[model samples]
Target: MPTPSAPSAPVADGGLFCELYWGTSLAEAWSYGPELGQVHAAPDETAPLPLYGFTLPEEPFLLAERTPRGWRIHVPPSARVEKSLKGDAFHPVGPEELTGAPGRAAVELREGMTLRLVEGELRLLVQPSVVKERAGRFRVRDVAWLITVAILFLSAPVAFLTMGPDPARLAANNARALQVAHDKEEARRKAMGLDQPLKPLTEAERATQKQDGGARVNVPASFGVR
Candidate 1:
């Protein structure tokens, strides 16, 4: 089982780094970003190594650093480097190969190039950073929707101001409504015969009428004789 470690640090401005894949498994890898500074490959007894069962030497076998062009791998004399996967043999390097003095030899790794180290136990791949543009130019269709919404918002007040009737027209409508109500009332009175002129009561009929507005009562002459 191969274990992958989280990025040691946040990706910074340089946006360049080297990815070390454990053996042939592409899924198990570690990213050495520029913010990580320098990375040393050495065995630690206290911490469990997640290098897919491969052990590094007691001394630093390899050192990885970020360079102006790309990532540079420093290889000790004891270690050998397989520069390419396309039939290139593992070659021994010395300090003289890079800086022309006595130190660990350095090799610049470009994008898509794989480097094999520690007798082909570890593999490193160089990957470039990808940036996406967040700000985009507005299209005509995008602006058209905004314009339509603004027009709808502005048209509400204009429609409310223009659609209402003027004061004179409102008064005329009220007068027409009152005339209709009066005409309906007159029609109802005529239907019930209440609209006809009343006939005057004679003197005998007036004598029988009640003074308290109650209905007139009539009594027979022999009602209490028995």
Candidate 2:
């Protein structure tokens, strides 16, 4: 078994690989091809597996090799395999239980199938790189959303200018508002007795009031005199 080391970059050959999921969350992923031959988990102090949280066996217990037909995983006594055929429910089985071989305990992994290791504390989702690559490519819906965003961005200024109030009308509105405010202030001053308006008497009323020989002869009707 090969000692666990830092995972290398993915190859462009679009080969099948296993995705390592720690419970419900994906932890790490490893790719395998004919060039690398096989992959395994063996303890190495210099460069340990990048996985965190859980510890793997100090010795090589889990091994995956590229077979002629597909990738085959060998299950040791310390670990048990749980295979999911429909991706929703899983069925637990011994390594030899699937192969029906008493001595050898190995099974080939298929695409879209999930495998769970009881002792390993992780699940493996089998898929090909081509599928992942295709999924990463932009779809029609993504392009349409981008177009909609661009249209909104480019049309923002136009919409604001079109829907905005006219400058001439705004100025007229401001003038009217100032006039109304002045009228209100004047009314408020009068209500508070801070401002008073003088009333001029008519000529006849002013003529009615006179003084004779230092005594008043007639008074204006406004003075409450008959």
Best by TM-score: 2
Q: Candidate 1: which stretches are off by over 4 Å?
A: 1-28, 45-62, 85-97, 100-103, 118-226
Candidate models: Cα lDDT each: 0.56, 0.61
Going through the candidates in the order shown, the clash numbers are 0, 0
- TM-score, cand. 2 vs. native: 0.43
Q: In model 2, what is the error at residue 52, expressed in angstroms?
A: 5.3
Write one digit per residue (lDDT tens) for candidate 1, span 1-226.
Answer: 8798854322232334345555666634444434544566544443222333334444444456666555676655444665553345545433344642334467765554456655355554433333212336899999999999999999999998898779899999999999999999999999999999999999878877845587677788767755
lDDT of 2 by residue, 62-119 (tens): 4566666556666554556788864578888543546634434677666555566555
| Candidate 1 clashes between residue pairs 3 or more apart in a chain or in different chains | none
Candidate 1 lDDT score relative to the true structure? 0.56
TM-score (all chains, Cα) for each model: 0.34, 0.43
